[model samples]
Target: MALLSVHNLSQSFGGLQALTDFNMEIGGYDLVGLIGPNGAGKTTVFNLVSGFYTPTRGAIVFNGKPTRGMKPHEVTALGLARTFQNIRLWNDLSVLDNIRIAQYHRLGYGFLDAVLRTARYARAEKNVDRKCRDILDMMDLTEFVEELPKNLPYGLQRRVELARALSTKPRLLLLDEPAAGLNALDVDGLIHLIRWIYNEFKISIWMIEHQMKVVMTLCQRLMVMDFGKTIADGAPGEIQNNPDVIAAYLGDGAV
Candidate 1:
């Protein structure tokens, strides 16, 4: 069975339909890319799947369970985690705390235990600290673990956001425009890290991106959207030659 299934998902904002009859299926360990022009509703798909917006007329199934009314945090707890187009880290928080906070859902300690400083709570805290540091090391951000996000470079901040998303321990990782503000070198590094994480962690990745190079190089399958609908979907090479996709993007002057 597919890990994620979106059947005829649709969304609207005061009569402007953002997405219409959208459908997709993602398998385990897959790297899928969603791409299109600026207003093609690419991010809308991510928002719907991540539970930021309730769909207007469709259903989503994650890990064989229905996700109609689940809240964003609820969806996240169900093994779905996402990063935003714009970095959304706590500017005042250290990188360590930023990643640690996302692991709260998995911490098996009660509030009372935390307040009373019980042994179990102490163990959990130690585990969290160790895990957060380990993840920071993996992302090559251990040196910046004590620094605020705003104090880091743009690329490092993006990595920190990705680290926080990974801290959730998701089966499915959704990234929205992760390369938006990156330079060429940073984008190359981002691509390398994405592939490394997908392989090392063995997690499925679904991404919304405007960077064609990243999309073509990393994604095993590609889905293109335009005017609130899927224009084409296939392997990267096939999608590159798709006439509808070429026309939709070029006509919009997006390419």
Candidate 2:
């Protein structure tokens, strides 16, 4: 079975129709890209699939279960985690603390256990600390564990956010514009890091990226969206040559 499946997905913001009849299926370890011009509803699709917004019409099935009414945290608990287009780190929290907080949903101990400092709470906290450190180390942010996210460089902050998402131990990772503010050097590093993560974790990755270099380098398949609808879906090479995708990005006159 596919890891995730969406059927007839649609969303509207009152009078503005954001997405229409969107459909996609991701296999167990696929790496796919979603691309298009601005306002093409790429992030909207991510928001709906990640449970940040409920779809106006459609069904989302993840790991063989329906996620129609699930909350964002509930979705994360079901092995789906995501990083936002904008960095959403707790600026005041230490890097380690930020990573630690993402695992709160799986603490496996009640408030009473925490208030009383019971064995369960102690064990849970220990495991969380170990996991957070491991993730930080894996992402090469171990030295900055005690530093605040606001104090780090833009690229490091992005890595911290990605590490926080990985701390959730998701089977599918959704990355929205990860290379948005990165410099050329940082973008190169990000491409390498993403490729490493995909191979190392052996998990499915679905990303919305506008950087042609990033998407073309890492994605095996690409889907193009324009004005809330999919215009093309095929291999990256095919997408690059597709007339509809070309027209959507460069004007009909260019086509």
TM-score of 1: 0.97
Counted clashes in each candidate structure: 0, 0
As a whole number from 0 to 100, the lDDT of residue 120 in candidate 2 is 94
Instruction: Give candidate 2's error at residue 31 in angstroms.
Output: 0.5
| Candidate 2, poorest ten consecutive residues by summed lDDT | 129-138
Q: Model 1 over residues 1-255: C-alpha lDDT tens digits?
A: 999999999999997999999999999889999999989998889988988888999999998889888889888989999999999999999999999999988899998998999999999999999999889999999999889999989999999999999999999999999999999999999999999999999999999999999999999999999989999999999998888898897774654
Candidate 1 off by > 4 Å: 252-255
Candidate 2, residue 77: Cα displacement in angstroms equals 0.4
Q: TM-score of each candidate?
A: 0.97, 0.99
Runs of candidate 2 with Cα error greater than 4 angstroms are none
